[model samples]
Target chain A: MQNENLYKELLRRFRLKVTLTRLHVLDVLANTPVALSHADITEQLAEYDIDKVTLYRTLNAFTKCGLAHKVATEDRNWLYALHMPDDAPSEVTSDHAHFVCDECERIYCLPMETGNNTRDIKEEQGFVIRSQEYRLHGTCPECHTQFSQQ
Target chain B: MQNENLYKELLRRFRLKVTLTRLHVLDVLANTPVALSHADITEQLAEYDIDKVTLYRTLNAFTKCGLAHKVATEDRNWLYALHMPDDAPSEVTSDHAHFVCDECERIYCLPMETGNNTRDIKEEQGFVIRSQEYRLHGTCPECHTQFSQQ
Candidate 1:
């Protein structure tokens, strides 16, 4: 999907009031494959003159509305990514595994097999396990090769 | 382990000189079963007269030395629990499952299996995956029963 239409559709589907800053934020995230931290977005969108609070609120709303998913990094801030809306029918969540690059500090969502039974986990405590986010940390292929070269 | 002994051992094991503030911080974390955020420790140890910066540094050292493990929570603050030294020499570091209680906001380490293979996961990425932390979140059995009764 083109930039303008993606944001327009996102706003319509999420019932979010469309705004330039929000669209720009969405656009930046949509184009990227790996998840991004708030610092990443702030630096990336610094040219746009967007307010920090607006960015926070926009990301928070997108996360709540199933337009994006949050990956918790070691540094204790959320790394988020565009969760393609049309992939899974039920809801948008980060059930997929993640890879946090130790050197570059990038987080990527590694897709896993779907229909994984979580009942064994839930039955143990009568606990409702709603969603799962699994992360596997390592150097990315690019970083791994660079480290070996050095 | 008692407070005084634990504090002294922490200093010796981590190769830091024994200090009043570090001891207090260590005591607070060790006494509590729940994984504590820095903010949580600060609030609880307010009377101990420790500097926040010192506390953060101490935590970083402890994490590096394998004296503690960081548990990921939704709040985006690094939460830590003391890694109790195990009797088994082979299993020094914590490879156990951790449970985060929804009602109590406590993180409990449940004794269970660990070191699940990632060789298959690596096949998908052609990347050498390193360590992983798996945390399960839910109401504890106690809370589950209480909620059901109500």
Candidate 2:
């Protein structure tokens, strides 16, 4: 399929050896809008019969090669998501904030205001800031509505 | 010591039973300017010979009672810090940012600009934001100087 080729090309671009597990993992990350944990990814790839250690290794490799990124959750766990390199002017791959629902513990991406960038502090403090993560803890719209009803 | 009484009073305020281990942990967190990991806290309290499980339980209790907060690092680990209740207008316990050094892996607290508060998005998007954590990843000044010198 065309999607498989695209995934293969992406692995090549990241200088990773093409593997079936890697392709399937990439496919899952690419399709999911919200970030997912290792357990979540494993559950999604259940039919593939991928080994848990292999999946973790693939995820780690993807993160190291900048193909994917990990967002830390409140429970000291990590959620992985694919980088949207093709989306021009995409905040998903750029500097943005993630809204974490306290109730359901779901992570949602939010476009950050460019005005709040760390350039000012970097210059003033002489720190070489390479990247930033802003995590806003809250009740998501769905959770908020559900809480109000209860 | 007077510090012990103060720590006990803090525990009483949070309705937690005063114990020697909790007092020592609070003392360590109070004196440390930067956030510390569980390992760091354990090492610091090694003289007391505290059990790892007990320390973890104490930390969880502190976090639950708002006596301390955890900042997630680039790694899937957390660094803990105490809440400064007496420092009037202190950003330490308020909504602030944390700078994580990629080289030394040290975490520093940064005072965030009040203008960048999430109040706007909370009103516009109807998300009930309870807290915000901005994590800036970079090389700290010491690490930057060391790397440049080499």
Candidate 3:
């Protein structure tokens, strides 16, 4: 499929070796709208019987090459998502903040809004900010409804 | 000391049993300007010969009772800090964002700034937000300076 080809091209672009595990991981990340932890990815790729160390190494390579980024969750799990280019609009990108449902431990990508820029902080605090992550912890709509019903 | 009494008072208010281990942990958290992981806290309390399980339990109790808040870091370590009341100004509170230095992996508490409120996101997204944590990743002043010099 075109996505598979694109994943291959991305791997080549990032100078990463083209491996089946990397491609599979990319496919999983691309299809997932929200970031997923390593465990989630492993579950999704269960049919492949991918080696755990291989999968971890593949993810690390992707992260180091800017192909993906990881978000830290409250449970100390790092959720991995693709890093889409600025021109590409993707739900999993770091362009916006993420909402984590405290009750269910699910992560959702929230839309980006204005007036939350970190440039001022960088200037004032003298920090060389390479990246930033904004995470909101709360009850999602489904969990809110469930709690209300309870 | 006056601070010791305050720690005891806090433990009493939170209904946590007053113990030497708890007191030491609170003292460590209270004195630290930046958040610390369990390992960091353990290192700080090495002289006390505290049990790992007991330390973890005490931390969990403190976190459950809202005496402390944990911020997830890049390495999947949860950095623990005190959750000061709104009237109290503390460097470790969630009132502001946190900055983690990628080079040194040191976490610093940034001052709260205007125009970064999450109320609008909550209204638009329909999430029942209990608390929010904003994290910025970059190089700290020392690391930046070192990198620049290098």
Per-residue error at A89 for model 3, in Å?
A: 15
* DockQ scores of all models, one per candidate: 0.43, 0.63, 0.63
Ranking of models by lDDT: 2, 3, 1
Candidate 1 deviates by what RMSD?
A: 3.4
DockQ-based class of model 2: medium
What digit string (tens of lDDT, one per residue) describes model 2 on residues B1-150? 349998898898877999999999999998867899999999998899999999989998888777888887767787898875663323323566888888889898776655565557654787887777887777888899999999
Query: Which candidate's TM-score is highest?
Result: 2
Candidate 2, superposed: residue stretches over 4 Å from native: A87-96, A117-119, A148-150, B87-94, B117-123, B148-150
Residues A1-150 of candidate 2 have per-residue lDDT tens digits of 348998998888777999989988888888866799999989988998889899889988887777877788878888888875663322323565788887888898665555564556564788888777787877888888998999
Q: Which portions of model 1 miss their true places by more than 4 Å?
A: A87-94, A112-122, A125-127, B1-3, B87-97, B110-112, B115-119
Stretches of candidate 3 off by over 4 Å are A86-96, A110-112, A117-122, A141-150, B86-96, B117-122, B142-150
Error of 2 at A9 (Å): 2.6
- Which is the better candidate, 1 or 2, if ranked by TM-score? 2
Q: State the lDDT at A143 in candidate 2.
A: 85
Worst 10 residues of 1 chain B by lDDT: B87-96
Worst 10 residues of 2 chain B by lDDT: B85-94
